[model samples]
Target: MRELREYLAACERDPACRAVLLTSSAGPFCQGLDYTCLLGLSPDKRRRAAEELARELKEFVRAVAGFGKPLVAGVTGACVGLGVALLPLCDLVYVSEKATLQLPYSRLGTVPEGGATHSLTTLLGHMKAGALMMTGRAITGSEALSANLATGLLWSATAYEDLIAQARQVLDNAAQIQALESTKALIRHSLRAKLEMALHSECRLLVHQWCAPEFQQRVRDLYDGGQLLLQKPGFDTQ
Candidate 1:
């Protein structure tokens, strides 16, 4: 998160950075919180920690959503939890055909954070959002494109580089590009006020859910089993 913040700050300062691309290293974009890190914490400490983490996550999403310049996300593998949430805030998203996206908060007995519930519903609608939360289903990149979660789909990781090149080519036309970006800014500005309210509300609910016994039990199950109980099958290591 600190690194992401620093990168964004640099983008803010650099006039040449017209579009910022976000992607992970070798593994999945992110598996969300390191459940192993939370395994040994007491209930109270866990609750407080979750609250703090949720607040930081909310701020990050807000920053991405309101960034004056366009933001791009390249998702290669597991894009779950806050990963799925944060991508929607980007102006454009590209995902590998093999990538899987999920929102596993309900299965973990915690409320959705990072403005996922609000933002996802706005993008995917109430029914699809509810299905995702309730079933904890993993959707493919092609499915994500169909659902409007992804703007483009790549056949392989190699293809992702080509897509980035294409994106850069389109952005290289400064005058035409700047005009389109200005229009986008105007549209995004109109939605900013409501998005702020939704983000704040999500933080509040997440804090409360973090303190709940059900959520604690879910964490305990993951700790005791050495893996998250509700994790999607193929991704579980243990």
Candidate 2:
């Protein structure tokens, strides 16, 4: 997110960066929180981290939604948690045919963040958004395209690579780049303020859920299952 914040700021000051393209060499575009590190934090440290994260998320979410230039996403593999939350904020999104969008907040007994609830509902409608949010299911790239979650499914053999190439091609064209900026601004004009509100609300709700019984139980389960532990080297739960 810090890197992204830097990129967004740089784009504004650099005419060479007329557009931005986001992709992941990591297996998933983004796996959201690193649970091992998160669970290991002491209470005070956790609160501090959460505060910083909340601030960064709010800024990042708003930046993406209101960015002046074209922003394209080339989603690959399983875009889990935060990745799913990020899609609707981009100016254009293309997902690999083999990619999947995973939403696990419900399964983990937590609320949504990154304004995903609002963004997804706005893009995908009430019923579909509710179902995904409540069920914590995975949506495939093809399904996402059909449901309008993705601009298109990258159907090529090297779909992720091709998606990036397509974004670059659009950026290279002066006429199309200008038109893209205009079109994005028109579409997002109504969403800018509301999206920021949702983002802050979502962050607040997520932080509040930290002490909720159900969410604590979910974390406890993972701890008991040996999937995570806090007394490892630098981190001390005590």
Instruction: Name the best candidate (by TM-score).
Output: 1
lDDT of 2 by residue, 1-238 (tens): 6667666878867776677777765455676654443455667777676677677778877777777888788777667777788889887888888888877787777778888878888999999988888898788889889988888778647875677678777776656666877888898887777777788788887776764455666877866885433332111000
lDDT of 2 at 98: 83
lDDT of each: 0.73, 0.73
Tens digit per residue, CA lDDT, model 1, 135-220: 88999989999999988887774855665775686587556757757976887775667778878887788777766677767878
Q: What is the Å distance of residue 147 in model 1 from its true position?
A: 0.8
lDDT of 1 at 210: 68
User: How many residue pairs clash per model?
Assistant: 0, 0
Q: After superposition, how far is residue 15 of candidate 1 from its true place, in Å?
A: 1.3
